[model samples]
Structures are given as C-alpha cells and as structure tokens.
Target chain A: MNNTLATIDTPAALIERSRMQRNIARMQQRMNELGVRFRPHVKTSKCIAVAKAQRDGGAQGITVSTLKEAEQFFAEGFTDILYAVGMAPHRLQHAMDLRRRGCALGILTDGVESARAIVEFGRANGEVFDVLIEVDTDGHRSGIRPEEDALLEVAHVLHDGGMRLGGVMTHAGSSYELDTPEALRAMAEQERSGCVRAAQRLRDAGLSCPVVSVGSTPTALMAEALEGVTEVRAGVYVFFDLVMRNIGVCTEDDIALSVLTTVIGHQADKGWAIVDSGWMAMSRDRGTQKQKRDFGYGQVCSVDGTVLDGYVLSGANQEHGILSREGAPDTGIAARFPIGTRLRILPNHACATGAQFPEYQALSEDGSLETWGRFHGW
Target chain B: MNNTLATIDTPAALIERSRMQRNIARMQQRMNELGVRFRPHVKTSKCIAVAKAQRDGGAQGITVSTLKEAEQFFAEGFTDILYAVGMAPHRLQHAMDLRRRGCALGILTDGVESARAIVEFGRANGEVFDVLIEVDTDGHRSGIRPEEDALLEVAHVLHDGGMRLGGVMTHAGSSYELDTPEALRAMAEQERSGCVRAAQRLRDAGLSCPVVSVGSTPTALMAEALEGVTEVRAGVYVFFDLVMRNIGVCTEDDIALSVLTTVIGHQADKGWAIVDSGWMAMSRDRGTQKQKRDFGYGQVCSVDGTVLDGYVLSGANQEHGILSREGAPDTGIAARFPIGTRLRILPNHACATGAQFPEYQALSEDGSLETWGRFHGW
Candidate 1:
C-alpha cells in the first residue's frame, strides 16, 4: 500500500522533506560562513537517512549522545563519529569495540576520575582513543569549567595515558532559554570562547590541543564569528520545533517534523477534539512551557501542514490528545474537527518527539512518501 | 554475559520482579474482593512478559490504548482484549482483521458519527464487533456523558446496525490529581456510577447491556465498591510510579520500574552528579510537577532500590541527568556519587518512562536479570 499521509496509520511521525532540506542547508550555510566544520548530532534523528542528508549537505562528521548511535550510524557506513556524552567507565568497552571496528569514534570526559578510566581502558586495549575534554560554557549540565583544575587534570590524564587528547568541546545548551538575538549571540560567544580558552590552556600546559568544537542550535545560528573553533555541533535544527521557534532561532515555517493524527472523538462543550497522538506519540517534552510562548504540547496544523493558529494540544493522556483553542472554548469543536478528520501537530521538542516513533514518514514535495527507520534505545 | 543489574548497560529500563508481582497481586486481590473481573491495561508496559505476569495473577483480560497493543497482546494469546481508546473510523478495518483471525478484540465509541461508521463497516464486512460506548465520568477527556442522549443514540446505532453492544466503560483520569483518600474514593464512585448509569440507560431502553467497566489507577484502588460494574481496568498500577505515590495510592517503595544509570561525571559546585540516563531514559514526564511534591525528573534511589531521601534528578538533557539534593546542593556530590557508581531513578510516570526503552531489564529476587522486549510505536 502507498504510505501517503492519508494511508499511513494515525499517530505516525511525519517529516516534510522540503523543510528538512531547507533546515539542513540553513545550518550548513551558517557553519560554512563561520568557516568551521559541521558535525550534525545524530542523536536527534538517529535515522541514517537523515544523517546522510546532513552529510550530503556538507556535514563533515557525526556527533552522537550514545554509543548505540555511533554503532548504528557506523554500520550504515558513516564512520567519523563522536560520542558526545561524558564517557561512562562501563561503556568504555563498547566504545573500544566500535573504534576497533574502524569507526574513528571520539569520546568525551569532564571529570578526572572518568578521564582516568578512559585512559586505563584505552591503554589496556592498546588503542589510542580520541578524547575531548568537556568544557562548561553555560553551566547548564555536564562539563568542567574552562578555568577549573579538572580541565588540565583530565587532559594530562588522557595525554599521559597514551590516548589522543583530540581537543575541547562545549555546548551552549543554555541558548535554548534565550529568545532574543542579543542574548543568543552572547551565549554563542561564551560557548566558542570557553572551549577555545580550554584548548589554549592545554596547549599552554605543553599538551597538544587541535580541534576546538562548540555549539547548540541557537548559539550555532546566532554566533557572529568562530575565530578559534575548528568545528561546531548542533541537533534539533534539522527539524525545528516549537521550542526552537519560541527560542527565536527558527521560524514556525521551518519546522519539518510533525505527528500525523486523526480526530477520534470530541468533547463539544469543553471544546476538546480528541486525537490519537498523545504523550505516547508526541512525547512528554514540555520545553516550550517556560518559553515566552507556551505551545502546551504542540502547535496544531492542518493535515497538509497549514498552521491552525491558536489551536493547540492543550492536554494529553497516554494515547489521547485534547486539542483545543487557547483562549475560549470553541464550542463548535466537534463540527470544526469532526471524527476521521486528519491533522498534524508540530512538537515542542523535535529530538524527544522523534524518539517516540520507530520510523518517520518522509513526505517529499512531489507527494511521494518513504518510511525511514530510527534507532530507539541506547 | 550475566545480566544482573550491575552488568547491564547504564540508562536501561529496569523492572523489579518482586515489587511488580506484589503490585499485580494487590490490584488483582482488590478486584476479587470487589467482585469485578480485572483487565489490566497493557499500555503501561506493552510487554508480553508483563501482560503474562498480570494474567498469571488472575487478570481475566487486557485493555489497550492502541491497536498495536491489541495486535501484540492478541498475538501472544490474549483473546479477551479491549481496545479502550475511542475507535477511529480508519481503524475499523484493522479491528475487523483481528476479529477475523479469532481474536475477541473489543472496540470503543462515544459519538454517533463514530458509532455509525463502526456499524457501516461491520455490516459491510459481515462482522459483529463487540462495541463499548465510552461514557465520560469525570469530564477529563473523551466520552459521552452518562445522562447525555448521545450515549443511548450510540448504543442503538451499534446494536441496531448488526454489532454486538458490549455495554459501557469510563475512566476517571482526573483522579490522578487527588492526593486525599476521600477525594479518590469520591472520584471512584463518580466513575463507577457514571458508567453503571450509562449501562442502565441502555438496558432501560430494552437493549442488552452485559458489561459495565470503570477504572484509572487512583480510582481502581480507592473504589470502595462496584455495585453494577463487572470489570475494572487500570494501567500504571501494574508498576506504580511517583505520580501514583503522590496520589496516595502507592508508596515510593511500591514503585517497581526505574531507570538504571551510572554516574559518568559531576558538576561539583552545583552539587550535581551527572548520570548517563537523561530524559531519553527517564522520559520528559514531569507528571509530579503540580503535585504536593514535585520530583524534577524522578526521585533518586540507590542501586539496590533504597530511596535516597531528598536526592532527585533535578535536571536532564538528551543523554545526561543531573542528580542533586532537594534543598541544598550537595557540594560533595562528586565524592558521594563518584564515577561508575550505579543508581536507579524512580520515574514520575511508569507508562511514559517505560515507553522510552525498546526493552526492559527484569530483575528477579535471586539477583537474576532477563531482557523483555516492548512495543514502541502504533
């Protein structure tokens, strides 16, 4: 059977190929202008086809959050991969295995203890592992501050232990919280300068620091310059979401990912059009809640991707989404969205939402559709 | 490789067998005392092993939120299955296909348009589907009100159009909001009376109404009696979560599902020990946010399931979780949860967290672990 939007099952992930290409080109162009290599984070899509599109758009290597993504992408013939999350001691063996299989995998570490473990594992395996010292640019989550003692300590541990101290990397993930260009540009500068400072510190300490990498979708786009950074990494930009829209990094028209759902029932008096796409399909990422504009669960759209302003998925159960207008109850909801009427919902966070579905229905501008499988677990 | 909790990969979904069995037994015993057949909702785990455990614990049938769950459970020999979500017209053929293959799959409907579509499809396809009219008991989401004329109209449409009217069902989903026992019991009665009243209305109109169903995790347990209800359906009770705990239905110790993770690094000044399990593992289910107690992502527990009071996953990224103290930053977090330290996080919602993983690591009492697969997408 033809897998058009109408024929496919409800609650299926839909990717507008045209918007995806545009998003991909936009990021690549920005990185190109900045004169830094683009290593698109595969953790967002985990789909080889999507990664291949990024590669075709000039992404040099791939960054992944888990070793499984490295393994999956490597097996599909994309070799240069970076395991971006801090290396766990228990997963060292898996990383080693992937590297030994000719997957040119790069791992990250922020703490002295974690760096020691990576060094010990690499030495024991007689493998010169490429390691990046995680630099804290925004203090959002993981990573050591550029000026922290642990930064030099981790670098010395990996370097002295016969491992490749590739460089320093940091993500200004805090950029997601900024909606203005001024704040985003400042965060971008902070991310780039922090990583470069860490790299310089290692170099000044008589350690070889080569590739300096930094980015987050907002910072990557808003950054005016990347004077010292050798490469930049970003995810969730290929399929801009409601969160990204609210962050002022991408326009709503740039969003490529949506869940194709069918109206199953309605609560007329309450003005709720019950749809099949619930938290189970759209995911539980309420990233837009704290942003300037809160798109409860998601922004509602027509079946063909026309924005239905003011209508959003106000609430969601396990398998049922309550689609309603934002201000007052549209008492004519039943008549507006009668049962069997198909619609699409743009998610709050593309990474979380895309992870919910096993495959995405990639719809081309010509109306042809293709099913692209995605990895589920670590 | 031995698959003990210690040996499994970090960021894995872990289910404690003993606690799950106890939870299953508790729910089953309550249904027995209340003289109602229990149909555990497989939407919680979506695992054949989990459903099998419920069946072994005397669960008579299964309730599913998606057709995929219905198909999977039926394929595993679960014959008395109920697709509890309101039936979409497009899915009628799939339902018929299951019934044609000897699966006693029951479908639900609440609106006249949906009922008419079901009748039309059933008549044209020469199938008599077991149809249940959904009654909205608590005004939480979908369903026709018990006293609404539409309930009778939907019943007649199904019965008079060559379909087997399977009575009525309702879920007091809003019961999840109440923490007090009085409020819970009242909500349970509201759900029960509302569904029973709908069945009575159908019977009073000279229609054969054999089944009357009502439940939600909170209501199912708090319900004092089920005077006219024949069956009960509850999902999250099979593996109670923090949301259930906050609702006063289960204690933190009763939570059987957790995300097994290992400390990969630390943000010392912030009193954060970063773990490999992020929102990808724990899910973005901030279900406890508005509750009396809000667990940022989840409550932190020791590797062996002991609750570490005041420690919670305060922040999460794609592949990183920040474990921190509730009131103050534990400045010695790096020492307390050093690298490679294994920990488990009790999720806010079991169903949402469980869906994040492709399979679960079921840990038994004797320090044994087994991998059980779960369905991902519909």
Candidate 2:
C-alpha cells in the first residue's frame, strides 16, 4: 500500500480521506465560530485513524457509545472521553480505571436508580467521575425530562457523592425523522434548550455544572445557533451515508464510505444484477425506511465509483443483493460488466455497515488503498 | 473460566445444554429418517465448541459462510466443509488452498459470471472443486430459476472447464416469512422441488449431478418428506430466536441464546425500562418486522432465564434498549428492575446478534455458565 498514492481494492471498505478531512474541518469551523467545543462521537468510525483526524481538526474531546470504546481510545492517547451511554454498576470498575489512568471521563445517566448506583459505586471505590444528566429532548429514546425537578435531584445525589456534575447532554434522535431543513433546525434548538435548561436547574440547586452538550448529525449540521450549548457531539457527518442523502443532509457525492463488491450473476428476464455485497456487508439498517423513497439497502454505484441512475439495490439476502431498475431505462448492466467486475455500494448507515467489517481499505483522492483498523465488540 | 463446571456468570446467552442436545438429536434423527445428509451450517454458531456438539450428534459435514470459518473448522479436524457463499474470484485462491489441505471443499454459485470466474480460478490453480448450483426458490435472495435454461448453461460451463458438479442447492429464504406449520410444509415442498428440478435439468444436459440440497430451519424441521433431496443445510434451528417464534417455527422456550443486560434506567411515566443491551449487542436485525407482532428488537426475559409474558424490547439506540409490555399481563417491569438488576434479551435474529459478539458465555441445563471460546471472523 502506498502512503500517498492509491488504487482501488475489493472486498474491503473504501473511505475517502479528503472527504473525511473536509467534513471534520467543516464541523469544527462551525462549532468554533459559535464559540462551542466540538466533541465528535467515536462510534461512527471505531478507528483511531479517524479519531486522530478529528483531534487534528480541532476536537477538544470525543464522545463514545461504549465503555470498551472509551478504553480503546484512552489507550491510544485520547484523554478527554465521554461514555455517552447510560452508565451501569457492572461497568463502573472500567470507568474508574480510565480515571486512574489520568483521563477525564464523563458518564450519562437519567433515572434515580442509575444516579444512586453511580453514587454508591463512587463512594465504595473512592473514585470521583464526571456525570452528565441525559435529557430527552424528543421521545425518540432514553432520557429524563430536562425541565423536571428530577434533574436537580439526580444532580444533588451525584454532587453529594463527590462526583463532579459535568453538565447535561441530549441527542435529538428525532432529528433523523425530519423531512426538511427547518424541521432539523427546530429539533436542534429543542436539543440545545433541553440540555441548557437541565443544566440551569442544576445551577438553581447551587451546583456548578460546566458542560452542556447537544448532538445528532442532522441537527448539528443544520443548526443556525448553539445558544447555551457548550459543546456539540456528532458522529455520522465524518462518513455521510445514503440515509443522510435520503434525509437531504448530503448528496451522493458527499458519501465517503462504501462497500466494494463484485458482480456475481444476472437474471435477464427480471433485469436483475446480483452482487456479492448483501445485507451482511451493507447492513440491514433501514435508516431510509422513513424517507419518501426507500432504496432497499443502498444506492448502486458503477465500478468506476459513479452512482448509476435508476439502479437501486432492491433487496438483499445474507450474502447476495439484487440490483434492479423498476420501469426505468434498461441500460443492460449485465452486459456492461462481465462476472468478477467490482463495484462500490454507498451504505445506508456508515456506522452500522462499517461495523460489520474488521478494517477499512482507506482510499486516497486518486483511489489508492491504505488499510485502517476498525475496533469491534463491547 | 472453570473447566469442570458451568458458572452462573452473565445473564445473557444462557444456553440450556440439555435443550440444545435434544434439538440437535431431533434434527439429526429427522434428517436420517428422511435419507438426506445433514451438513449443518456452522455460521449460526461460529464457536468450534458448538461445532464439536454437531459432530458428536452425527453431522457428516458442515456449511460455513466465510473462508475464515472454513479455515478455523478445518483446523479443528472437520475435514468436509461447504463454503456456502457465492464464490468470488478474489476468494477462489483461498478456497483452493483449503482444498489442498485434504479438506473436501464445495463452492456455491448461481450466475454464469461466477461459474466462469470459479472455472478460471480453478484452472489457473490446477484444482478441482465440487460446485453447487444455487437455485432461487422464492426469490429471497440469489440463485438461478430452477426451470431456466441458465442453470444448464452454467452447469455445462463448469463441466467444460473441468470443475466437478457436486449437485444443486436452494434455500427457501421466504420460509422465514411463514406463520403456520402448513405454510412451512408448503415452503419445504417448494424448496425440495426447486433443487430437485435444477438437478434434473443438469442431468438432462448429460452432466453428472449427485447432490440436491434444500434448506431453511422452518422447512427442514417441518418437511414431511425429502423425496429427491440429498442433503439439508439449515442453520438457525440450533439457537432459535424471537423471529422463529414469531414465524411459528419455534417457541420462546426453544431459544438457546439471549443477551444478558443490566437495567440502567427507567422512564416511569412512559412505562419503559432501559437495558445496557443495544444494537451493538443484540444487533439491528429486525427479523420480526414482517410478522403480525413486530418484536422491536427482541423479547425480554426475567433474570432467572424465563421469558416474561408481555415484555418486549420496544426500541433500541446504539447502546440502550427500551422494554415495554407487548400484550401479555403487566409485570411492573419498570418499578421492579433497579439500576443493577440483570435481565436477558432473546435476539430477533441469532445469526446477526451472534456475529456482533466475540464469544458466548455458554450455559448449562441448570442456568450455570459453561466454557467460552472466541468465534472466527473474516
């Protein structure tokens, strides 16, 4: 593999380096202009190579979805790590180890049970960690009400237990449900306000909450104002996928990661082209299911890395994908490529699909291969 | 870690040794009575430890989804292996190497392109590989039509290129869609007839076709007659999941694997309990989406390893899942589960969830932990 030059590689993930750098820089510039810290989530690309790019591009810290990821990134010299998932007692020992290793660790918690568990674990282990109260801006997933008194009660318990109250964090997971930029912007405000209001409740209770984090790629990219948000944590923007395109977040040209597959067969009667990249390689993440048009799994691209018009992967099995054009122009894709011809498929969700493979064959601007490691499992 | 006894370690993936043994023996006896060879697909449980169980239960051969799995099982003294995935030119050399090590290797192909590629690779490497012509039974994924002349053409091409034609194989991927035993039996007939007809077409073309394989857990377990079928290659039956239950293939008690997760939080107002098991652990495979009752991701069970009547995971984020009542009696799950209480989740799709984790903390009949070994990955 060449350090600077490149060639296409098959049966591997091809990530565009320049596109990733641009995405990171774009997010950083926006956050910096708004006077907010950028703490991009590390779950999208569980690779140290991409995390370093974020750090180099001006990330003050990083958000992780798993404690395993926090440990891996910390070992690789990433000090300021946030375990974004709701922390449990079974994983407290691992969190304490990260703190002992001279790293600032922040954990997300919502209910009194978790808050009490954290307090009890901290008291028993003599470990003082940062706690972030996860506020549910939209009823998309887990979190407590930001404006409720429960926020202060949870904060008081953590503060009394010697654990520093970091602040409040909320993901506008509902932003992924938006159909327009205005909707995304509105959700972004809700996310910002939710975290800020939760932090304000902590302040009203005489607690010094420092950081207010808000995130979700769709909202983070479209938000016009950060307001009271101290930091932004978005992950999927580094590798925009088909889901982003369907939601109008990006275009086909903006997608940076794809699965390289080979044409295995053709059904002339049905005008179906079979490819080796199936749901296993592309992932069954139907993030685009809510969109107006559902591209079964992903958008089919040509061997030269160009998105083919009217051709979509209609369905996928475990090891095979069916490429078809429903009542569209018949270009005879079967004749264009004989068997063994390789093509790249832009994924529906980059994080989900990329997680399927162990490593990525990073492609330079000119299309050369450079292997980059991807961490897996919790 | 104890070699002599099963330990009560994690609550997730508690395997009942006796139940598994019975399931294996039943399938083996049924296939034997049908006069069809049992080549259990090993992708369901990539653990060599589980493969040993299959071998001990009289599995003559094993099917693998990846070359890495083939290599691993071959090293474990499993000589006969069928690489069930479509043969790509890039991976042909690896398959040839496995054959050179005195392993009986069979490759699957459905397209003329793959047929030609496999022939070219085999000719170049001077190796003879047994080939299975995959027939598309219900259009679930990949394969040629059983009645299409393309099947004969591909078989003729393989024979002309000096590759031995092993027989025909077809999977009724739609069998997973059936909700009745009658539907399953019908799918089994369709699967059997499809492969048998394809083999007949090859024989009519003056080609020697010895094997005719038909499979799918539902079809294999419910089919009354094997007729012209030479072998069965069903996977999922060993570790039934929520999807199987929804499809009426197996009951919740038949499921062997479950993700043990600790309750992290709860939304008392919404009546939701949050667990540490997310898509990262349980997988994003919503296999039950087409069923009448869509198990959001999995069925929730008590810590004692019993399925709760009405509890089902309603939604999942990257690292958190929400469990709520489906239709059964309310068990006050939200109030009962504290932050540290452990729960078990039966996966929607065993193959997908099993692939996410590195190893299983195998359990015994009495809910005690057994030995652990890492799974092979590409």
Best prediction by lDDT:
1
Query: Tens digit of lDDT per residue, candidate 2, span B1-378?
Result: 552122232324555567678778888999999988999998888888888898899888999877888988899899989888778777787788889988898998888778988888889889888999989999777788898878888898899999999999988988888888888898899899888888888888889989888898889998999898888988888888888888887788888888888778887777778887877777779988888777788888776668876788888877788888875534566667767677788888988888777677776655456655556236
lDDT of 2 at A304: 58
Can you write out model 1's per-residue Cα lDDT over B91-112, one digit (the tens) per residue? 9999999998989999999999
Weakest lDDT window of 10 consecutive positions for candidate 2 chain B: B3-12
Interface RMSD of 1: 0.7
Predicted complex 1: DockQ: 0.91
* Residue-wise C-alpha lDDT for candidate 1, range A1-378, written one tens digit per residue: 687887888899999999999999999999999899999998999999999999999999999988888889999998999899998888889988888889999999898898899888888889799999889988898888999888888888988899999999999888888899999888889998899999999999999988899988999999999999999999899999999999898888999999999999999888889999999999999999899999999999999899999999999988999999999999999999999999999999999999999999999997879999999998
Candidate 2 — which residues are off by over 4 angstroms? Answer: A1-10, A328-331, B1-14, B327-332, B374-377
| CA deviation > 4 Å runs, candidate 1 | none
What is the C-alpha local distance difference test score of each model?
0.92, 0.82
